[model samples]
Target: MDGTTLYAVDGGIARITLNRPGARNALNDQMIGELLDALDRAKHDDGVRVIVLTGAGDRAFCAGADLDGLGRDGMGVNDVRDSAPFRLFTAFPALGKPIIARLAGHAVAGGLGLAAACDLVIAADDVKLATPEVNVGLWPMMIMAIINRNVAPKHAFKLYYTGSRITAAEGREIGLVTEVVPRADLDARVDELAGVIASKSPLGLRRGRDAFFAIEGRPLEDQVAYLLSELVELAGTEDAKEGITAFLENRPPDFRGR
Candidate 1:
């Protein structure tokens, strides 16, 4: 796992780079295992205030599962979800920290699932996004699960049934991306966002993020209850104390990603 998946930390930002450029960062079993493990590691590591997911080269953030994840020993739709697709990131909302997908290249099929599941996504204007599995006789079944959560049903169906690739700019319009920047500006933009995220109290960030998703599918009364519960839970965390003290002192508070 040491060289197969590169992990780097600068300030509070942890970057997870999928290292199989030769395979276009495809989700081979090893890559899948490593990504899950890396996400687990990123969540537990206090130094990691936010995570940035990217690939090793210019060709793909991921081309979805490897050519192998589709064939004889390949994953079926449900298997891909359980083994490597949306489940990996679906487990993420509980982490209470931001995970941003820095789409430096193409994100198709399950690769698009990666971007869809992230808390934020930023990509180059030229970055390609698609659920091209239909062209190969498979619909974007697993990817569709998350896609429906993030996108309109009709558009999600259009992406699945058509299998046409879209630019990152179009992805933003369709709710699949957060921002589209020039290729040269992708990293700086993600880094800037990471810094802004780090500026907030991590405890409140986690509470709010959890409440946000928890309330999304709930009624108004339930939403208020959930938010109130989150507030109570957050009041017990250290960041609350630091945040209040910092305001009183008129100085920046250093956060510990507790």
Candidate 2:
């Protein structure tokens, strides 16, 4: 609420922007809390079908955690376990709605964690990504779990160990980014994807995304069974019925998020 983060909803999409351009939109405790709050708002708002997270300014999507704000003291186990920044990472998947990261510039350390937490990430072709905690005598311990899931283990370890950076195209190759486009095309590309996703059945998106996160660590057989039941539940939703009828009638479906 300190204006370090901005949140707005329009056209069924919730836009959450980190507003600290002067600091390259670095994550501070307040900013992390604001972002988590915004995510919660969007998740509960029936009118919001999609969320887009981005940083202010063209210089950087995020330069990572604000070292000054993070301070130089080791924390007790309780403090470490209850850190607010950790909420930002977990909130995305728990929201049960699609989140797209609009990366206009570099994303390093915690910044990369934020992007990786999103369901999809679209970055400018010239943008870069890195996990440079090692360069500063620190480890990206909080984000490692997310980075591990998104990037190949060997490649991720190499980046973490060497403190190297990768271009957006390279990020796409490593499965860290979903799409890369010219800087000028970034907004259009993000809007296009958000609009397309926003037009889908909200109930379907929420249910599917929820199932996605839930079945992640399950066995293959269990996953198949759970997914089958999830599909049956989805089929019973009013939006699903309307979607089917609309398709059969060659008409646009009006989903009410039922």
Candidate 3:
């Protein structure tokens, strides 16, 4: 939408890159707006089967929110709730498609929240991650929701309270990072993963992702029931039928996002 963010689609994968390398690709209002716009576009585009979120620079995936634009007192509850970060992070999982975070550098504070929001987060092995809001006498109230879903409760609290950064390996071990690769191999790894996901039947991927998101705070029994129902529903989709036909015929399936 704007130079603050860059959006491109190629080979069924939509790449959303946060600009502003000088600021470590910080989430300023304009950048956030542009990123949200890009996400909305990618979500609706039938050609885009997968989304990859990354930053422009090698120094940091994101240094967090742009404090200069936030003013002296920073944001209040209403401001935070209305901000693009809140909407982007909270609404991401429900988009009915997979999103992968390609992190080649540090992701601190709200940056970590953005990474966690994605379905998969692949980071460079040397990357740093943290939620250091408490160090500034503030709390990562909004981000904690997404972070808690990934990290263990005690470990999440430790990151929030101590303002200490963790390595990509530790982040993966704690469930925050999906994969860790050497910096030089980050792009290859991300590409490999994106390519694999992009080859799936779009209809099945959407149904599966949506079903999983729908069961998020539900009981195990409810989750299983919903998943079973979703499976039956998916079996009725045109793409599912085509996939089965292709498998039986020894041919590649052609999914139309049906």
How many clashes in each structure? 0, 0, 0
Q: Rank the candidates by TM-score, best first.
A: 2, 3, 1
Number of the top TM-score candidate: 2
1-258 per-residue lDDT for model 1 (tens digits)? 475588888787888999989888888767766777888888787777788899889899988877765443325554544444455657767766788999988998888998888989999888899999989898876668778888888888889889999889888988999999999998899989998997887767777887777787788898888788878878777888788788899999866644
Point out the higher-scoring one by lDDT: 1 or 2.
Answer: 2
TM-score list, all predictions: 0.89, 0.96, 0.94
User: Which is the winner by lDDT between candidate 1 and candidate 3?
Assistant: 3
CA displacement after TM-score superposition, residue 166 of candidate 3 (Å): 0.8
lDDT tens string, model 2, 1-258? 449899998899999999999999998777877888888999898889999999998878888889887643235445654667756677777897899999997999989999998999999998999999998798988889999999998889998998998899999999999999999999999999999999999889989999988999899999999999999989999999999999999999999988
Task: For model 1, give the RMSD to the true fold.
Answer: 2.5
lDDT of each: 0.82, 0.89, 0.88
Segments in model 1 whose C-alpha atoms lie over 4 Å from true places: 1-3, 69-87
Sorted on lDDT, highest at the top, how do the candidates line up? 2, 3, 1
lDDT of 3 by residue, 31-131 (tens): 87788889999989999999999999888898888988643223455566665666777779767779999998799998999999899999998899998
